[model samples]
Target: MRPAGKQPLQSLYFDYPLFEFRQPPELHGGDMQHPVVIAGAGPVGLTAALALAQQGVASVVVEKKDTVNDGSRAICVSRHSFETLQQLGAVAAFLDKALGWTRGRCYYRDQLIHRLEMPHSEDERFLPMYNIQQQYIEQFLIDKTADYPDLIELRWQSEVSELKNSADGVSLGINTPEGSYSLRGNYLLAADGARSTVRELLGLRLQGDNLPGNYVIADVRMAHEFPTERRSFFESSGNPDATVLVHRQPDNIWRVDWQILPGDDPDDAVRENNVRERVAAILAMIGHEGEWELEWWSIYTANTLCLDNYRHGRVLFIGDSGHIVPIFGVRGLNNGIADAVNAAWKLACVLKRLAPASLLDSYSPERRGATIDVLRNAGKSSRFMTPPTRGYALMRKAVLELALTQEFTRPFADPRQVQPYNYEDSPLTTPEAGAGEFTSGPAPGAPLHNCRLDEDDYLLDHIGHSFTVLYFSIEARPSSELAALFAQLYQLDPACCILRITGAADQVNEDDVLVDASGRISRAYDAIAGTVYLVRPDRYVAGRWKSANPEEILAALRRALGGSKP
Candidate 1:
């Protein structure tokens, strides 16, 4: 076998199984089988599996958990992720149980200081943010993939004990109930979560710091006389200082979280009497004397950490396995799910021999950059939730006070701060020089945008199957040669779409807009006349030119398609 540090292909193929030349049933006239093995069965893992399945790539998912956890961990699904779910054919199931939330209020000292409503339409690419449990999300994905033969096989109760990667592929030692078995695949994905055993086996370390505080979360049912439409944030007024976040579930149950006291024992914090007292205290603060019934309560520490590397050879990490941020911004789960979507299609391309092995390197730089931003936002939100110093407290109060006015609320209402993070310097991004002030050009290492192309249309449907070449020109028609070449390429491969623009266009404006879905075309592509942009499947700019040159554009396409240099 080749040494571990060598390039992926040499190492992977050095000691992998050799396939015999034979005709197979699935490949009646083909010669190769799809190659990808994913670890874990969580939302991230399932998302990766479903994305691959949607692309006709065969994969397998192994999970240690036997069944889904009936917990209310993740609640808010962002507009971008909502669009992704729709693509996976799981949006309908999620909408069935999700509660649409269009407004949020921030309270300081029992006074409503800021209230903002979402600026969105019902028929937009994605609806306003929805509040749904993670369990339901997983169930929907699992049900959606039930009939896809090309999809993954859910190996419940299967845990991966060890993983080894070489130049050609990956081999995993999975510990099953029956016995330990070795499985091989072209690439292995580690969506196994924060305490991932797969990450440890690969000798990769999670690099980041844990915050200096913790919070207590409880799932309880309360019969109260409060507005069910509004989510309540209550500041502490009693001993054992706390802030309570209360919101109603679709099942008529209330999800409540009480910020824990410093140096409090979590095990003892959830005792029957302690939970009762906490509920009673919250009720009293809200001026209600109703019956508060406790269902489940747990104390958790809100720690923020990120992995130094998301890829270790053929085994790539995604989701909590790569990064863990505080729950204040509700981005941890969302970030993980987004990572799955990013890595899934890329892995499929590599396995299908459509993209080069070096493409995997882009995964870490892209997702980690986004995760770092998530941590930063979560840190900021945590400070707002639990300000550390007097100065910070004063600033928080001022922002809230300003939010009370319409003039100040308009900026804060955008919620762009909590949107998906952008990638700024990834290797996958092509350099765009001398193209200024246009939105359609590519940024070398930037993350995708989270907003829709337009108010009425969704960006997800437009970007499907292959890379997109968005040409924005003020000229009446596209360059004939460029248009013909793109049309020929699309006719040869219907998986891609080449859209031409001139003068008046809807959805995007000039700027650096490159993302999988929901990005401003004008922002990234420089909506200037006669400009052509080449976007990759994951929605990053691969290359761009002032005007279309078929030869130069074809070379860039060849590079993106994993072809060797001329």
Candidate 2:
């Protein structure tokens, strides 16, 4: 572990020649011509590759690990992230093996403090969160990538030892089992884990500290009688030196974690018989004791750290390389997945010449801002889990006890506190006053609602293909001349897809401004009588306007297309 400071980089030295003598093979197909190369076969890298392939851009992924490790880490995926995966065609495989949880509870000592029933809508797609192992996500991504041919070459056992970047692209020196070889890519994405070799080589600085807390994580099969559908947390009894958390997986397996004192030897505490004793103690605490089998056990130190920047010229970082938050909120993996989705499309646009290079600049500010928000939220959740002092613990307990009441729980049910994020300051967002608000006239930065089009009941599924524009009324529709101009623009820009939703259509009345498939339009979007909304590829509202002014719409499109003159 290196200290937190600017350290001089060490030069690379090899005992043998860097590469065995061989002629460089000629690259094949437009896929191989991609400028970006991702190093790591983790979920973030695989998601990025999948996103790029879906957009018709190629990428190469190199992994030192030969196979995906079936460790049950990163077990929770958010609704937004699940939708993003579905867009890449990887969610079906994940859903086949995932566990859906619509309820969560918090316990303090012998009292149930907080209980939350997940949101349910007439639309089933937005129901519950999914829980699946991180490895499953990686495997699903790898399987779906077959459609892209050789766009993503997963060279197992290939390790990147050195990296060099210039104004053009990145040059990587990789050491493989056979021999060493050099790879040149227009861009490099570092989705490697926390101790990233790419970040170290680039001399990038991680911004936070490794907070003082260590815990032991164990995956075991317990033959005891306990609720398998709920997550349980137990506070320390009389002694603040210990705490326990248990999560039950869909496969009937249990994941148990116990907090360790500062001087505890984690390895010694995880002995076979010792593990059984700990399980027995926990079961006894809950008044159940039975036979149990241990599958795997390990210790980890929790830290809240983030990189200062997500991009440096052609080399970009995602996943743990960019930020790592406390696990209480289950935000780390979900945040990384979001980063991959955001970067993959921009990289594809740049490679295909559909959008200018300036589009890549949005990755850092948007993701970094989101990362900061995750840190703050995770920090709050962590404090709720492990209060700093006796007074804090008492306060937390009181709050949770109060939250058990219906009146208090109703306010806490607002998912917006967890789901809302802004890309308003992003370089890609158009500059308009009150762009961040949900106004009627075409203003940039309006979020996408789960809405529908005319004669269609499934708008969420249809809107996933590409960027979309929806008109709320027939009067808001662009004139024939403007429609023709937009048709040309859509022809030139393969990333933007347009759809119209109007009151003149079935199930809609003239009084209805914006009617979703389910006919539920809240005050969130204001539902103006005659207005149009422009959504980005990632589904954030980019621009909205009341008038069908083709020139204003074209100007907004130009700004979104990377600051080009319309």
Candidate 3:
């Protein structure tokens, strides 16, 4: 493990997972059927595979590329993504290698205009964000799949050339290093990427707008002490009339994104000579006298495109295949991770007969709702970063100009970081009135709070596939009533992991009781004695009540399972 602030072994591309086809049974004779098949081996696809594996469902992940991602794209991993990674059992490696930060700064020309701090305190398990290269993330996820070798089968250099979906399942024609083969699966995950073959074969189209502006991202290696904070500059003398972003990565590598004019030829913009010149000029502008080497460079346009729907029959789209948003607020990868978690749990439930197959239908609405939310949020940052029209550019200019002087205008210059998306309106969550005696924390459909259960334990570590009925009361342990409540809960879903939290710690028994040592959980959840919460597998607040009512809890639990009221 690379210790925090330690450099990694310098490398260009991540190591590949080689899968040799030596008399594979699926291809040797008849078509082999699997429970789930993932079409891409990127972070999202691999995460989906691992998620299914954790639920005891087997999956086959197919990847055209032989190795992890090339270069360092998507450098920012949001805290929400880290939570999902922890649930998939790949977060230990990530925490060791990732650069953690909680603050971001915005500058106009040379003056510091605004500073935004993400919510982080001693009570939280992880920080607001971590800056790790995309390749490293993919490598960590790949390492995790090895732990569940029987449950996860990773195929390298295997591309889905064609796919046909039906009422039963999806039929896929895979082209591999060995030869073309065929396989059938009960469900297919189209995490193939932005240029998805599954999407094309299915005759689906992404509908949205693309900004006219483009960004040249140059990853350079150098040693420096830049406090690991997100920094953005607009109309700076170093890179005059352009917007530049700087983020620090591990191994002494740094990623700088320079927004270029719309007229700049994409071909010439990515040239090494041009990229180096721009990078060098910006480095000098920032007063970095240290020597540096250009490692890699790429160009990307600010796009806010997504499918009209994320689900079609047995095929579910995830990651860039389903949506594309600006990278400024770090929503792209985070939202993709959410897609994997959301789909993984629901898919596993249906495949295991724990929930009705109709549960899968709710995925599109919930995730599509999330995608729309991302588009709406990222659209603001996209327009702010790359103003599409002259009027918008002038607006930004005025905002940046006033930000230098007026304190009130400084908020306008701040890049509103990604928010934990709420599914209050999702079909899966039980909607209810927020009116209650103590209404704090998140209501139904909101992302659950992550608090420190102990020095190394987290409250989220206990949330999973079953409905976790958090009986937050003043009881020292499971009361008789609570035992009966869980009896019904276990009958409804045996996967549930129950925990009791209370205001008293010393009075509680050690088994099945977690004392809110710091009262953060109770304060965060606005819980009093008898207050209870039903958290879904993805750790979203499925339903909460001021008091425990077995009938009401069971009714909401059934609703979360996509079944009618009992």
Top of the candidates by lDDT: 3
Q: After superposition, how far is residue 313 of candidate 3 from its true place, in Å?
A: 0.3
lDDT of each: 0.65, 0.66, 0.83
Worst 10 residues of 3 by lDDT: 1-10
- Flag the better candidate by lDDT, 2 or 3: 3
Candidate 1 contains a number of clashing pairs equal to 43
Clashes of each: 43, 8, 0
Runs with alpha carbons beyond 4 Å of true place in candidate 2: 1-34, 222-230, 236-241, 284-291, 388-420, 431-447, 451-457, 474-478, 503-525, 528-530, 564-566
Residues 1-566 of candidate 1 have per-residue lDDT tens digits of 11224432222111222212222222233223238888888888988898888777878787877666446667677676777787676788887888776676655456665565665653356555777766677777888878685566777767788777987888777666666667777888898888888888877777776765566666655666544333445354532355667766655556677776556786677776777777777657666666655555556667778778888888788898988788776687788877987888777777666677776777888788888788777776676666666786567557655665545642332223356665545555545555563444335434333334455444445555456776765544456886687776565345666755543544245332223232245544445555666766656566776766677677666655555543
Model 2, residue pairs in steric clash = 35-186, 35-187, 441-544, 441-545, 442-544, 442-545, 443-544, 444-542
**Candidate number that wins on TM-score, 1 or 3:** 3
Question: Per-residue lDDT for 26-50 in model 2, tens only?
Answer: 2221223346789888889999988
Q: lDDT at 228 for candidate 2?
A: 35
What TM-scores do the predictions have?
0.79, 0.83, 0.95
lDDT for 456 in candidate 1 is 46
Candidate 2, residue 255: how far the Cα is off, in Å: 2.0
lDDT of 2: 0.66
